[model samples]
Target: MADELIFYTNPMSRGRIARWMLEETGVPYKTEIMTFGGTMKSPEYLAVNPMGKVPAVRHGKTVVTECAAICAYLADAFPEADLAPTPDERGSYYRWMFFTAGPLEAAATNKALGFETPPDKARMAGYGRFADVMNTLEHAVSTTPYVAGDRFTAADVYVGSHIGWGLGFGTIEKRQAFVDYLGRVTDRPAHKRAVAIDDEAMKIAQ
Candidate 1:
């Protein structure tokens, strides 16, 4: 089958995360840039992903959508890249990956909307209220050099993207741990290449 990876993305959107992950893994992927009211929501795109979102991937006939799932999927599919955890690393891998997707993004979005979860049932909330989630994230990032121990696995692509976006948008508190972490990750040669290419494209489009 060629094992070619195809990506549907809008350079201006969250699909940028997938781009960076692709760069990190040193894997080649074809990009089909879509527009807001354009192919993203089309029936053709919807066949691959009912949600019709950016950051969907095609590997032959199998399609993968959702950024977290995409990151995990590609990591396994490209075993030579070693972007995923070993069997023993599953616990921390899934924990931090889903933490970025569920709690971190939820808290950041809630912060952006200026809505606060009620204190009474904060624990019941997946994000566990903003302060709790944010502080917990700060602690989590501080303790681990990477999300899953010393290895930089697919979890970093998920979690580091959160830290990068949160810091950029002022959604997260921009604590020192986040700042340092973002700095370390962004300094990576692959990340810089992806960011430079994407940033230049955005400037041209503007």
Candidate 2:
């Protein structure tokens, strides 16, 4: 194998992010679908990702997990796609990318679980509060077409997916800025192709 990319995922999981990134890269890769509570937790698969998560990829001897990381990795790996930032843009690109991965994810999950942060304890929360996180995100996207700056980058791939999914599932409250940002980033042919593939797979699985 001369550094082939092997994608392990389930259609319904965060693997959708990686799928979108892969499609954006226009990369050819083999996909292995694993069912929850079965092959996903099996010893063989656990060896690949101890977390038993979907959206794990093996590129040659390298194995990468986490949706945001995979998106950033693919962008850097496929520079011709222009999904990565130049050195000058790296700060903004990385800022929002990690913000979504850490604070945004935590805030959304906490809200979904109905875990409210007491006022006094808000300072201790990494996301401060879901409302604050949402406000900050809305502001970031409102300032630019993409998360990082004037152009679309890997940061948009990661952050946009979360916002889009959050809006679709009602995990994140509706905001005009979010709606507009999601529309702009997700209008690409790559995103549509990825959605079509996953939608078909989801229908089949159902």
Candidate 3:
């Protein structure tokens, strides 16, 4: 028998990113929809993720949290999907994945909350300046067809989700490079299916 795969998520959260990666893997898994301040904080879910966050995955006895980690794990777990990067692609794959997960996420959240790092204190911040992050991101996406170069890998799933969400929510700048890169990565059946599932889940939650 195979190990069971379970996905915990909320439609209105970053769980959508993990959902897309799961769909891309074409694996059979169970979805557990959690609501904010409710099931998410329950002891049951808390045991699975001490942070009580959605988008955690339990494969057999192994539990993985964080969207970036989940994407990487799934790609490696189901290599038949070919989402993991090749040897030469590892540099860019891990680079952009961590970049988006750390710097991009922090900068965008701070900007949306109308908080900016002081020029003098920018040196203390991991993301430095939001504008610098945006410019770097633009260069990253514009320089290659995909973040890992020439192919769509798990890195794309993680990085592209942030760009897509940022663009939709006005957290990311409206650069032509960003718009083009987003279009290129998301024009796939897996992405479409993920969106549809989450959209329906949102309606149910409402």
Candidate 4:
């Protein structure tokens, strides 16, 4: 059966991560762009995601919500692309993937709001704490060429996307590892293609 992909996205949201992964997978897909102020609240879109968030993917009958989940799902679903991590690497894969969604966002969000994590119980959080999270990220990215090591994997797609968006949004500083990782990931042909499409779309909108 042909894999039919319906990507529900809003240009200004986290959906961009999914978009980059889709391109990396090199699979053709249909896009359903939603607007703000009310388009997302429509009953039709809400039927797919009660949260009414963008970056949701409908592959055939399976509906995958959440950006990291969508990235893993697409890579797994399209194993021919060699983007999926091997069974041995699954643990580390999930670690960084969820780390981005869990701690990175928590730390970045808190930082954006001018709050800091208290040292006493900071490790209790999945990301440990803002500084810990940053340090952990720095270590992982600085020491490894990709998230899963020498060979690139789906985890890189998620982790790199976080780094990319973080640096772009000014939510995170342009550290060496982050700058280097973002440069490496964005250099992929698939990523370049994805950016071209998104860029054209933006130009047309303007």
Best by TM-score: 3
Across 43-118, the per-residue lDDT of candidate 2 in tens digits comes to 9999999999798999988899999889988898878899998988799899999999999999898888989889
Which lDDT tens digits does candidate 1 get at residues 1-206? 57778888877888888888888888777878777777878999888888877878898888988889988988888889888878887888898789888888888998899888889989778888788787888776777788777867878888898898888889998788888877766777878888887787676431
Q: Name the 10 consecutive residues with the lowest summed lDDT in model 1.
A: 197-206
Q: Per-residue CA lDDT of candidate 3, range 12-111, in tens?
A: 9999999999999999999999989999999999999999888899999999999999999999999999998877769999999999999999999999
Query: Residue 203 of model 3: what lDDT?
Result: 86
Ranking by TM-score: 3, 2, 1, 4
**Cα RMSD (angstroms) for every candidate in the order listed:** 1.7, 1.3, 0.9, 1.9
lDDT of the structure predicted as candidate 2: 0.90
lDDT of each: 0.82, 0.90, 0.94, 0.81
The segments of candidate 2 whose C-alpha lies over 4 angstroms from its true place after superposition are 204-206
User: Relative to the unseen true structure, what is the Cα RMSD of model 1?
Assistant: 1.7
lDDT of 3: 0.94
**Which lDDT value does model 3 have at 72?**
94
User: Which predicted model would earn the best lDDT?
Assistant: 3
Q: Which digits, one per residue and each the tens of the lDDT, describe model 4 over residues 105-194?
A: 888888789887678877666666677778888887877788777777778888988888778777787788899887877788887877
For candidate 2, report its TM-score: 0.96
Q: What TM-score against the true fold does each predicted structure earn?
A: 0.93, 0.96, 0.98, 0.92
TM-score head-to-head 3 vs 4, winner: 3
